[model samples]
Target chain A: MRRFLKLVAIEWKLTNREFITIFFTLIFPILMLLLFGTMYGNEASEFMGGYGSVDVSTPGYINMIIAVTGIMSLPLTLAQYRERKILKRFMATPTKPIEILLSQFIVNILLTILGLVLLIVVGKIVFDLHFFGNFFEAIFTFFIILLSIFSIGLLIAGVSKNAKMATAIAYIVYFPMLFLSGATMPLQMMPQSIVNISKALPMTYGVTLFKGIWLGDHLIDYPLEIIILFSITLVFGGLAVKFFKWE
Target chain B: MNVIEVKNLIKKYKNFTAVDHISLEVEEGCIFGMLGPNGAGKTTTIECIIGLKNRDGGEVNVLGIDPNVDYKKLYNLIGVQLQETSYQDKIKVYEICELFTSMYENPVDYHILLDRFGLHDKAKSYLSQLSGGQRQKIAIILALISNPKLVFLDELTTGLDPKSRREMWDYIKELKNEGRTVFMTTHYMEEAAYLCDKICIINDGKIIALDTVDGVIDLADIDQVISFETEEDIVQLIEKEIKGINKIEKENKKLKIYSKREDLLTDLVIFLKEKSIKYRKIDINRPGLEDAFIKLTEKTRKVE
Candidate 1:
């Protein structure tokens, strides 16, 4: 237990040392909230379909945090550790390798929650954002989206041959979803062809489902989104476990 | 008592036999060196004994424990530094020490270890700021921090400077003085001769020789080469007339005499004097661990 605590602390420190993770998770989402909130004035705007600009993108920004930790930081760190044989070195110790893995999950998941809370706080303070859905329902749906995206990151980490390849693949998957899934941009303003493209992306469903719940719609009304997110979680999570490599 | 015992151990990577039915035993409180060429399966055998790799056949016992089945407990007693392993680049030197020491059952104070390695002042420096030699030194220090009853080091001084290498040799000797069994593999012959009480040489996934430094040299049976600069071409004369000579090699006026006979040098002078062949700059080269290692790993069949 002492060993695990030390590993978690070390992993946490190491994660903090990464500038990109910090920017994407903590700084960039706030930038987005402030950027969009200033332009649209946080009023019930027709541009966002009766939701305030900050109100809508605020939840979407939580998905953005999920993308940063789940798709970018988590997979990249695992790949770098494996490529460098850091995992093998730790394995030779009395510490179980699983503890190292579990600590990463714990740290990334906690960071996602922290980022989500920060976004919500900024939205509430700066824009007086309205929350109409049940608070518990919002928390529950946030986790489902978090898991599905994180599992994709795990799958990416498992299949990549090296850290460099992992980065390239992660960029390919993440950048498109970042811009197209309405995580960063309002999908209502996109060309009809781009909106059609978002239909095929998994994050679009996540954002669409999460936005609906954030706008006072119940989770049961979005069965397709719930089923799709759970399917992604089950399939990608299983494949990640099957193909995971320690070295 | 034997700290490590292996019987007919075998490990294969796909169809290629990596560790082919090899066996050796390491007694307590001695530095046992494994010497072999690249791709000779030395690392594979170490991995199997350390429980990092599974054996295809045969049994391995480390400190009376089956490594493959009970490694978590066994690891508390043994320290290992794998060759290709590395530290996290963003982690500080002190943090790495703390993290590694936390995993052991009874770890020594790593601060003292860092001071011993001359890394005390670099505690705050990230791994990216340190040199390769410094990181390698940390690996060695981390291995000892476990206060292990047994230590396994693969290529312990491959990237170290001369000072650090000598320091490591002295420290490893100190480990043996403390009654810790040390098992290591290195390509440096002098390092092995200076550090190892017993040595094992494997080639082609099989044990070729396991003996002491001089014993391995003797086992390879390499003849000493006696060289002399001769004014005349007496190669045929030395070959035909000299007694106790195994073979003769000549390049121009330089003649090299290879023989296992102890009296070949004396007999060669007498023969050359009888023939009145003027010779100067005569020298005899005795074979050491390197010649034996090369011959044993490259040319010999399995001898164990």
Candidate 2:
């Protein structure tokens, strides 16, 4: 247990030392909230389908931050570690190789939670964002979304030959997820064809579920979204475990 | 007593064999060296003994534990430095030491280790900020931090500078003085000759020679080279008249004699005096580890 805690602390320091993880997980999300909140204003606007711009877009931004951290930042680091034989180095020690993976998960999960808290704090202070729905349910859904997204990152890390390949593959998925999933641009403003396309994206479902729950929508209406997220989590998580290479 | 024993150990990768049926033993508190060319399966053999690779046949015992079956139990008793050395690039040096120190049942005080390796002042520097030699020192430090009874160092000084290499050699000597068993692999013959109590030479996945440094040199049977600059063609005379010469070759203006017999030099001088051959310079060069390694490996290749 002491060894595990030490590993977790070291992993935390390593992750924070990198600029990309910090920017995407902490800085970028807060910047998005402030930038979009000022432009769309806090007042209830018909432009965002009868909800205030800050209120409707806030969940999208939050989910976006989660996706960036979970998919891009976390997996790239692991792939790089493998490329550099850091995993192999740990395997030779008394420390089991699995402990390194567990520490990475713990550190990234903590960072994701920190990102969420920062977004909420900034939103509440600057935009007067109000919570109307069940608070616990939102938090639970956030965790599920995190699990779903992070599993995909694990899969990427497992199959990628190196960090460069991981980054390229991550960006290919990251940009589309951000722009099309109502995370950056409102899904309401997109064309019917683009909206139909966004429905196929897992990130879109995550953002929709979070937005619906945060604005007091009934949880029972998004059963399909929950099922999709859980299914992706299982499939990706299984594959990641099956293919992960220490060397 | 032997700390490690292997019998007919075989490792295959698909249709190719990486380690053939080979056997060796490492005694306690000895610096055992595995010397081989690049593709000779030295790393693979080490990997199998450390439980990083599986053998297809035969048996291996390290410190009375079966590495494949009892690796978890053995982990605390052994340390390993792989051929590739790396850690998290942004992690500070001391943090890496502290992290590794926490992994063992009983660890050496890494602070003292850092100071011992001359890395005390660079404790707060990121891995990226350190030079190649410094990074290699950290890898060595991490392996020793566990304070294991046995340590495996693969290609320990491959990328180190001359000064760092000497420092690493001194550290290995210190480890031996502390009554620890050290197993290492290297292509550097001088390193093996200088540091190893027993040296094993492997070629094409099979060990061709295993003995003390001088014992291997003796086993190669090419004891010395007798070279003399002569105006007359004396290769034919030396080959016919010399009693113990193994080979005689003429290169440019010099006659080179290779033989296992220690009296070959005396025999050559008598032959030269009898033939009235005048030589400008004569020299006798004793075979070292490098010569023994090449001869043994060549003999193996030829037999195959």
Candidate 3:
């Protein structure tokens, strides 16, 4: 257990130094928040149903951080380690290869939590964001959202043989979801065709579930969203485990 | 006692057999070397012994445990440095050392090991910040950090400069001196001759020769070579006149003669005097591991 903890700590330190992880997870979401908050202040807009524009997007921003770390950084790191034969070296030691995989999982989770906390703190300070949802409900949202999105990342990492393939797939999965998922823009404003496309994305449901809970709705308010998120987690996470490559 | 024992070990990749019915033993407290040309299955054999690859047939016993069945237990007793393995860019020297050290129940202080390689000052440096040789030293340091009973070093000094290569040779010898058996694979024949107490040459997924330095030299059954430079065309005359001349090569006033004759030197000197031909830079060369390796590999090819 101590060795595993050390692996996680070292993994965390390494993840924190990655330029892409630092940029997207730690800085990019906050940048988007400040930009959107400045453009559309906390005034209650009719489109948001008596809530401010920044308030509605704050929860969506949390999911955005998830996509960055889970889909973009996580898969690429794992694939690169395999390509470099670093995973094989670790296998020759007494330590189990599963420790390396689990360490990455824990480090990414910690990064997501860090990004979420920063967004919440920044939201409260800069835009005075409202939080009508209970903390118990918020904690529940945390695990399921990460499970659904990070599993997609894990699946990509499992199949992609190297960093190059992971990058290609990550972009293919990340960009469309980032723009059309209503995570970046309100779904009410987008055209019907774009909204239809967004429905195919897992992040779209993540945004909806988060957006629902953020606006003082109960966790049970969105059964479809919960069911979709939980199912994505199970299906994709199972595939990731089945097909993951060590070399 | 043998620290490692292999019985008809075989590994195949698809239709190609990488290791075929190979068997050898590594005795405790000695440096053992495995040498071959590229694509000779050296790496594959090492991978199988370390449990990185599942054997297609046969058994591998390392420190008295089957590597494929109980590799975790075997790993605790052996350390390995692979030919091509890398770490992440952000990891510091001591940090990775600490991570690897934590896995073992008893580990030597890596700082002292790093100092032995003259890398103590670079302990906090990131892997990306170090040069190739520095990183190579770190790879070796990581291998020895656990102070295991047996160590496996693949291509140990491949990327090091000549000076560092010599240093690593001494360090590897020091490992044997400290009663740890060292199993290494290297392309450098001189390295094999210098450090290995027992040398095994494998080619085409088979053990071509396994013997001591002089023993392998004898296995080649090749002739000692005598070469000299002379302005005159004496190749024909030497072949015709010399009774023991097996073959002769002539190029640009240089004559190279191969023969098993021990008295060829005396015969050649007397013949030069009788022929009234002058020769300069005459030298006799004894066979070394490189020559034996080539001859043995050629012998295997011819038999097949």
Candidate 4:
């Protein structure tokens, strides 16, 4: 346990020194939330009309965007660490690789929560938005969405060789999650073929669960969505552990 | 007893053999030097000994523990300083020493180690801000922080200036005085000759020569070198005049006459005076380690 804590402390120190971590992990996300949140404002609902047949002001669109952004955080951070050889150095230490991975996961979770808090603060102060519909359910769904997204990111970072390639591949996975998961547009209004494909994506269930919670829909009806999120987390997390390359 | 032992160890990267089936032993409390050229499998052998790489064949025992099976225990007892000093550029020297020291059960005093390396004043400075020699000093200090019974140093003074190189050598000797065994690899022949109690000279992943410094030098065969400056064709003259002159070569405007005869120098000086040859200078000296290394390796290559 002491070894694990020491490794975590080292990781923290390295993260603090990395300019990219300070920029993308902290500053970039906050700037993005503030900039995008205000630009869309009340028109966030109107922006949702472009994707599908669902009504724009159904409260589902806001929840979808938040979930998708939360998912994006995981890959961006993990890939950066892998590309910089931070994971490789950590592995060279006496600490177990699993401990290092756990520390990174915890740090990423905290960073995502901080970003979420900032987004909410800006949303409430400037855009007059509220996320207070069944706060416990909302928080539960948010945690699930964060875990699912983080798992995918871990998988990508572990498998990829370089940062640029990881970033490219992550975006290839990211754009579809945003566009087809009903984050940027409503999936219900889209063509049947597109909806079917998007439903298979991990982020799709997270967006659906978030919308269901926000709109006070029946949680029992979204069992498949919950199951899909949990399943994706397990599969991706397992693959990450098995195939992760430190160097 | 041997602190570390390897028998016919081999490591292959695909088709190319990095560490051939070579065997050697490191006695406790002795400074063992693995002397070789750049690609002579020194680092590969060191890595294999430290359990950082798996061997394809043969056996290795470090401190009575097989590295492959008992890596955790081996790591606890052994300290390794790789050729390269890699760390977070923003980390201070003190932090690096402290962090690495925490991994061991009994660590040396961090400040004292830093002071020994002359890095006490630069403790708070970031790694990027320090000079290459200073950074290397810090790396060495980090390696010693654990106070391991056996320490591995790979090319410990490769890129340092002359003064820094000598300083590092003194520090290594100090470690030896503290009764710690050091297994180091170096390309510098003088370093091995001066510091190593026993040296294993490796080439092309094979042990060409293994012995004490004086033992190797004694085996070189060639004894006296009679060097004299001359512009004329002295080779033909020496072949005709000097009876016991076995070999002759001209290097840098001086003719070198090699022989085992002790009185060859006196005879040559008399001959030069009697002949009235206006030579610039004359020198007579015995063979050194460099001569031995060249002669042994050169003969080995010819047989191959």
Highest lDDT model number: 3
Docking class of 3: high
lDDT of 2 by residue, A79-194 (tens): 99899888888887667888888889889999888888899899999999877779888988889899999999999999999999999999988889999999889887899999
Comparison by DockQ, 1 against 4, better one: 1
Q: Candidate 1 on B1-304: residue-level lDDT in tens?
A: 9999999999988889999899899999999999898899988899999998889999999998999999999988898989978888689988998888888888999999888878999999998888777888788888888889999999988878888788788888988998999999998899999999999998888888999999999999999999989779777767778777788888888888899987888888888788788889999999999999888776755443
lDDT by residue for model 3 (B36-63), tens: 8899999999999989999999989999
By DockQ, rank the candidates, best first: 3, 1, 2, 4
All candidates: TM-score: 0.95, 0.96, 0.96, 0.82
In terms of DockQ, which candidate is strongest?
A: 3
Off by over 4 Å in 1: B232-241, B268-279, B300-304
Docking class of 4: acceptable
* Candidate 2 local lDDT, B109-186, one digit each (tens): 999988998889998888889988887788778888878889899998997888888888999999999999999998
The digit string of per-residue lDDT tens for model 1 on A36-56 reads 788877888776788777778
Q: How many backbone clashes does candidate 2 have?
A: 0
What residue runs in model 4 are displaced by over 4 Å at the alpha carbon?
Answer: A36-93, A124-129, A132-144, A162-201, A217-219, B217-224, B231-237, B240-244, B250-253, B260-263, B270-278, B284-304
Alpha-carbon RMSD, each predicted model: 2.3, 1.9, 1.8, 4.6
> How close to the true structure is residue A195 of candidate 1, measured as C-alpha lDDT?
99
Q: Which parts of model 2 are misplaced by more than 4 Å?
A: B231-241, B269-278
TM-score of chain A of 4: 0.73
Q: For every model in order, what is the iRMS?
A: 0.9, 1.1, 0.8, 3.3
- Return the clash pairs for model 4, or none: A52-A189, A52-A190, A53-A189
Error of 1 at A182 (Å): 1.6
